[model samples]
Target: MAAKPRVATCSLTGCFGCHMSLLDIDERIIDLIGLVDFDKSPIDDIKSFTGPVDVGIIEGGVSNDENVEVLRSFREHCGVLVAVGECALTGGVPSMRNLVPLKECLEEAYLKGPTLVGGAIPNDPEIPLLLDRVYPCHEVVRIDYMLPGCPPSADVLWTALAALLKGEEPKLGYELIKYD
Candidate 1:
């Protein structure tokens, strides 16, 4: 028998709501589980892996060095890469904080009053600094698919996935769901 297509997923620096959305697919996910093989989802049953991944859905913006690694790795492995959620699409809520300086954010969270002392700031040598603003996945690397929403409506996801599975157009040129 031929092997099922492989799909790998991960969440970078977001609320992890996208992951929950996938889980919320209910019986559709059960059907998907049978149709596609999951390799390195954040919810993977396995701990670590090193193999070619077919479809990579990244759910968050690139905020630091690790995010760069994650994005590159996913692009390298996956035949088709997808960026899910507003965070992955446009850096989402986290990028909204970009209005404030990194130091100000750090101090507000962990330097001034009611903050952590001896702090290991995230953008330092050991950590990674964020860019000035949020950008969508395609801005960094080529993206095969992009699902943009603060958290995209599940109905939209279902329709897109169904089209993909059928080997038909998946709302690439036309609008599947209206956006504000």
Candidate 2:
């Protein structure tokens, strides 16, 4: 039997709704597992890539140094890199920070927020440095495809993955493309 294509996925700086939508495929997940092998994906609890992957699915936008590092690694190791959901395509809700200066945003969250009990802005080697603005995945690296939706419906994800697994371009129908 031929080896199944391998897929890897990661979430960067947005809400994890996209990953949740992947799970929403429900029992079809069994079929997906039969078609593809997961590598370096939270779906499989694999923290690092074992080898080159056929596809790399990325959720969320690039907002920090670590996100950039991971995204670049994905580009280097995956044959096809797909940016899924609004965040990866256009920075989504997190991009709102682009309007406000990063400094003020940090101050509000760590020092002056109403709920905070007074804390210093974090500055540690362990914490990844924030970018001046959030960026869509494509802005940081070459993306082979993009699925635009707040959390692209499960059907959309299934269609895209199925097409890619079969070595064809995904042709999403009007009903499958949604921005909400």
Write model 2 residue lDDT over 1-180, tens digit each, in one string.
988899999999979899999999999999999898999988879999999999999999999999999999999999999999999999999999999999999998999988888589999999999999999999999999999888999999999999999899998999988888
How far residue 106's Cα lies from its native spot in candidate 1, in Å, is 1.5
- C-alpha lDDT values of all predictions: 0.74, 0.94
Output the number of the TM-score-best candidate.
2
The digit string of per-residue lDDT tens for model 1 on 22-53 reads 77777888888888888887777543346886
Per-residue error (Å), model 1, residue 177: 3.1
Clashing pairs in 1: none
Residue 23 accuracy (lDDT) in model 2 = 98
Q: Best candidate per lDDT, number?
A: 2
**lDDT, model 2, position 150:** 84
